[model samples]
Target chain A: MKIRTCKYFAKQSVKSIWRNKVMSLASIGSVMAALLVIGIFLILVLNVDYLAAKLESQVEIKVHLVDGLSDTIIGEIRKEIKGLSGVKDCVFVSKDKALKDFSESLGENSYLLEGLEGDNPLSDSFVVTLEDPRLAPQVTLAIKAMSNIENVVYGKEELEKLLDVTYFLRVGSLVIVAILLLISVFIISNTIKLTVYARRREIGIMKYIGATDWFVRGPFFLEGVLLGLIGSIISIGLLATGYYYIARYVEQQMFGLLVISLMPFQEVLKSLTVSLLAFGVVIGSLGSMISIRKFLKV
Target chain B: MIELVNVSKTFSDGHKALKNINIKIDNGEFVFLVGPSGAGKSTLIKLLLKEIDPDQGNIIINGKDVTKLKRREIPYLRRNIGVVFQDFRLLQEKTVYENVAFAMEVVEASPKEIRRQVPIILSLVGLSKKSNLYPSQLSGGEQQRVSLARAIVNGPSILIADEPTGNLDPDTAWEVMKSLNEINHRGTTVLMATHAKDIVDAMRKRVIAIENGTIARDDKKGGYGI
Candidate 1:
């Protein structure tokens, strides 16, 4: 084909977009809404999984010392534990400090502990962190056999529950993504088919005039892509703003100890834009092709 | 030149539209394809355009067998043939100039050539002043003229007009025929299909008349074979 002919078809494709204004708007609106919803869920799930992961990293086993252990013994235990490659940090907490901390956590129950409070029932021990949180059990076992250590307590149960939650979320997110993508394609295909049905006469004319399969189909395909692109942009913009407030409120009100990264706004937008555009382009083109296929006999 | 030998088109519903059709149209000949309604007139045109193919037969155009042509080669085949339709199938959104330029565009005519040939052809159809007018803005006769301009802009050797004057007043129909006659006089083959006996009588061109899907008469100078 000549360059001028290519330009003509390109122009015709653009004119076609305006020719069927209502259908075009409908396609773009629905695609945009769907993309926006999917985008929001994607961000939420990703961040929740990330926050859970951060919680996992912080999981550690606390090894308390026996009563009347010497300062030298405490120091020696700390050195030995730190020397272990998987151990991250080993903070030594005295019994008195532990009692004070427990009282604070106990809130109004502190009055009930008044008899035990002055005596400092808690023992001094190392609040041990591990380089690999999964090695918490092994690290605790090693510490329990130490001379001055009396007991070992950590977020063993909590970490296990956290892992369960992460596993569920990872699986659940994939299922949701798959369902959403399927829904997107189905809705888009129907939307494009309606557009094609409306323009059957134009298609007939194009075919009778010897318009190639691509020439007749190109504009509609382009419209589908443009719809997806515009829809994704609208969705991403709304998602970013909405996510900012949601993340801020969640961070402020919930446990700040396990803060979630909402992820940088720029990265989310850039990736969503590319992905949605690709999605829209493929879906739109596919929808258009499927819709117009019956009419493009020649 | 166009040649159709032993062409037959049967639909899935077991209706035969054309039967054992055989005809040859040489370059620079103006002919009329006439018949009653549903007489397989459109089917013949479709076979030539490959809009619908024949079940059995050969269609040779300019010494090339179109029956064996690839799917991609249809556009190139169309580049050499121009068509004016009954309803004046002009792109509704486009202006007269753009509509005429579309044929060239489909064939990839350069911008310089479009700028050069578009106006001269628009004038040939007597639509020079309406270059910027949309199809809806024009009268039925004027719209058909725009269609004519669009059809002939590519300077095709053969022009297939399927009932070109079907929707026009008698005066307008004559005007369209006059435009077609002028093109024929310029040595371009014109195959016009019409049920209007008056136009065929007036033109006195070679007429190929079909009745019930088979060639009934081929006249050197005829008037609708009435």
Candidate 2:
């Protein structure tokens, strides 16, 4: 097509959108709403996974040593635990150090432990951190099987539940987002269908006048793309503002008590904008193309 | 030039629209297709336009077999032929000038060519002064003239007008006919289908009368006849 013709078609598309303002707005509104929902779910799932990973990293198996083990045997046991496949680090906590940490945790109640300071009862243990918290059960089992270990604890039940929740969130959000995208496409296409139907006579006249299929379809396709782009940008703006406020609120309320930290808005903003724009454009153009296909047979 | 050799079309519901049709028109010839409402005049025009395929045999236009043309090539073939409908299907929102210019624009005609040719064609159709008027502001006959201008704007060799004056009054119908007559005089082959007996009898052009899916009569300088 000539550059002049392309410009004319683009102008026509913009004119059509302006002419059918009501339908155009409705289409944009639906696209924005759908995208917003998808965006919310996406951020929620991503943040949940981030928190789960942070929590997983903090999960460490504590191997309590049998009382009165020699210093040489304690070193051997630490080496064995560190040699485990998932073990990232194994640091030995001496009985004296363990007692001191317990007294500090008790704060003002340190006086209750004053009589036992010279004769510490706390067991010396190896704090074993793992490369993957999902492997906590296996590592704990390995630690328990070793000689000179009294007990191995790694929050087995809680860690299993956390992993399961993260897996479900990822998969479930994906399915929901896919369905939302499909619905957005349908809404957009149907709205465009009304515009095309309203111009059926015009299209017929064009065809009769020897307008090629592309010549007739080009303007409608452009209209759809523009609608998608506008809708996506607006939705992205709303989502970013909403996410920033929520992240600030969560940080203030949770303070360091909970490990649930949100991903910073700037980190995801670029990719989110790009993907939403792409999705909007694809849905809009595809909708227009599909709805206009039947009418172009002339 | 147009040629139909043993061409036939049967609708899926078992209605035979065209049966064993055979005819040929040399370049620059003006011909009238006269028939009753269901005499298959529309089907024959559609076949020539390649809108619907003939179930059997061949339709050749300008020595190219239309039946063998690919889907992508149909538009190009259509561009070489102009079509005007009974409804004068002008875009209501567009001015008389834009409607005509649109035809040229679709074929990617240069801006300079469109600016130059659209005025010339509108003058030929006697709508020069009304170039800025929308279709709704024009009379039925004037609207048909705009349709004519749009049809011929691309400079197609053949013009197929199906009942171009169907919605116009008698005097207005003649006005539209005069435009077609002028277009023909300029050497574009004109094929018209109509039920307007008076126009047919008055013009006395080459008339091909169809009846019951077959050509009933073909006459040069023929009047309307049952």
Best by DockQ: 2
TM agreement with the true structure for every prediction: 0.84, 0.86
lDDT tens digits by residue: candidate 1, A1-298: 5555456555655665676677667667777776776676667556656556777878877887778977887888889989886988889888888888778767777887787856777788778888898898787778777776778887767656766776776677677666765665565566666657666766665655567777777666666666667667777778778877776776677644434456665666676677766766766666666656644444
| I-RMSD for candidate 2 | 1.3
Candidate 2: misplaced stretches above 4 Å? A1-9, A52-61, A67-122, A128-147, A153-159, A293-298
> What TM-score would you report for chain A in candidate 2?
0.77
lDDT of each: 0.78, 0.86
Worst 10 residues of 2 chain B by lDDT: B102-111
Lowest lDDT sum, 10 consecutive residues, model 1 chain B, at: B102-111
Native interface contact recovery, all models: 0.32, 0.68
What TM-score does model 1 achieve against the real structure? 0.84
Model 2 interface DockQ:
0.66
Interface Cα RMSD per model, in Å? 2.5, 1.3
lDDT of 2 by residue, A97-196 (tens): 9999888867788888998977888899989888887788888887788888888887766766877887887788788778877777776677667778
